[model samples]
Target: MTRYDFLPRLVALPGVYRPQADTRLLAAALTQEPLRSGAKVVEIGTGTGALALQAAARGADVTAIDVAWPAVLAARLNGWRHRLPVRVRHGDFEARTQGLRFDLALANPPYVPSPDARLPTRGARRAWDAGTDGRAVLDRICEAAPSLLRPGGVLLMVHSGMCGVEKTLELLGREGMSGQVTERALVPWGPVLRSRRAWLRNQGLAGDSHEQEELVIVRAQKS
Candidate 1:
């Protein structure tokens, strides 16, 4: 069973990203953290606020932020339905969370390698379409992590292994935060990746015979 199996059914609205393998992996990692009651937690690109709600149910004060209005609405509604108090807000993660530091930071940012160079500002593509290198959002998250967490605070972020997991660790290390991959699960490529199979293979992000993608959770701590 998943870590969220015991919680009430979540309400996922259209256009908002649905909690999938990455979300489940991050949730499992969250269970391993030593969270005390009333610990401050922030979830960036919160989608339906699944991870934030998990922290809230465990007594952590959670603030969830997303760029889409539909996601913000879905998160607020889900929090009410689950009886979990989460401060769901609609805005960019860095803009909305400025000047705030938390004990724990969670993220499931876009890491898909898209053919397009510019990131999407709207539409469902925004959920998963990163730039050609697939590090558009991932790099930003790693760069902002130090400012988002307090001393000794931890960051739990999940992304596709094709997006350069080692680069993520290196970026965090450069920022003085040590990090390593804590969880990994192989999942079959969904429609998004399947649609770009040929491109991915040509770009060396995927192989012709491979149909599965490895998802990994990176746990980084601020020193």
Candidate 2:
């Protein structure tokens, strides 16, 4: 079997459906912030628990949630491998978390539109599709985030630039919150390349192999 078929392989899968340069960049951004040792942190869609593990490594108390059972198991194993303390749980981001509030929340939710989507493993449907416009998951998270966060808490999320960044800003504004782009980068959309390339070829841009995906990291704060 290929390495990807191994249980440990899940830990190496991309957190986002596509390659996300900004997601890794957000890790650096988190390092620069005032993340006190043992600060409470909650991560939504904790694929492979990469970000959550990073936070835990910095001595932060972290709870990571994912709808995918295999991903959760993989994350737990990854945490074990690194000797990091991160609680990986199978849960939905839109649901309330047992009255728990956190100092920091992070999510790299699925922001890809349907029709051109790749199915996550059977256990990860909610982790991948964001509905027709690709904002269903994000909308729910934004709506629920204010309640999940403590006063002065922050929520960090990464999404595609094509997923309507301006609209996201507007939604956060309506939620009585504010956000700023902490990082942005161009990365290849390896997940949808087959469909994307087909569409490009149909439009007579076949030779234009410069198709790129944009990654935007936004940090929102509840007033």
Candidate 3:
């Protein structure tokens, strides 16, 4: 068997965010969990349904939501391609899944801090570019996590350290949710960060000499 035989073959459309190091890192952490068959799982920002497929492959009932129409289509196609049953939704997580809770919540949201104050409504950048502080999407996830998860449910979210991991923990903590960093990795700066080097330095999120950033996976559980 080749590597990643477990995951479905994915086809990310043009302008859709493709899986990268961060995606693999989250998937690795996910595999370690004792996921039972038919567990309810919801993946936010399910670009190409990568993580959603991961859960489905393990026999979990999964629902994947994406804000971009192209991503929704890609995810549905990938699910069909592999014969995995994933309910693909077209909308943001909080809005689309309101009043619903899941056994597991997964997110790999836009955490890259962009110079622009407004988030991109259209373009591939929407998949990666958060607002100036990079918390535009991360903050929303932290706030919505408690509501999205059921009692004893777990949230597995990945984001760049530039957005403030402690802040994520703090936001969850305010909601009485307990959280801790389960994984961390330093990855070399990618094209996006390289282009924003000067701005990131200006915002004090990165150093002029820094060449890498930490990607953190936080596992938070509801009581």
lDDT (Cα, 0-100) at 144 in candidate 1? 92
Clashes of each: 0, 0, 0
Q: Please, what are the lDDT tens digits per residue for candidate 1 over residues 1-223?
A: 2467633477778888988888888998999999999999999998888898889988999999999898999999988877889999889899998899999999999999999989999888889999999999999999999999999999999999999999999999999899999999999999999999999999999887989999999999999
Candidate 3 deviation (Cα RMSD) = 1.5
Off by over 4 Å in 3: 1-3, 6-8
- Clash pairs, model 2 backbone: none
Give the lowest summed-lDDT range of ten residues in model 1: 1-10
Compose the digit string of candidate 2's lDDT tens values, residues 1-223. Answer: 2112222333544332322454576666676667899899998887777778778877889999987766777788888877788988887765637789999998888776655445445633555566555787788887887888898999888887767888888888788878888888888766654465665456443356667877888889998
Candidates 1 and 2 compared by TM-score, better number: 1
Q: Per-prediction RMSD in angstroms?
A: 1.5, 5.6, 1.5
TM-score of each: 0.97, 0.82, 0.96
**lDDT values for all models:** 0.91, 0.73, 0.91
Worst 10 residues of 2 by lDDT: 1-10
| Pairs in clash, predicted candidate 3 | none
- Sort the predicted structures by lDDT, highest score first: 1, 3, 2
Relative to the true structure, candidate 3 reaches a TM of 0.96
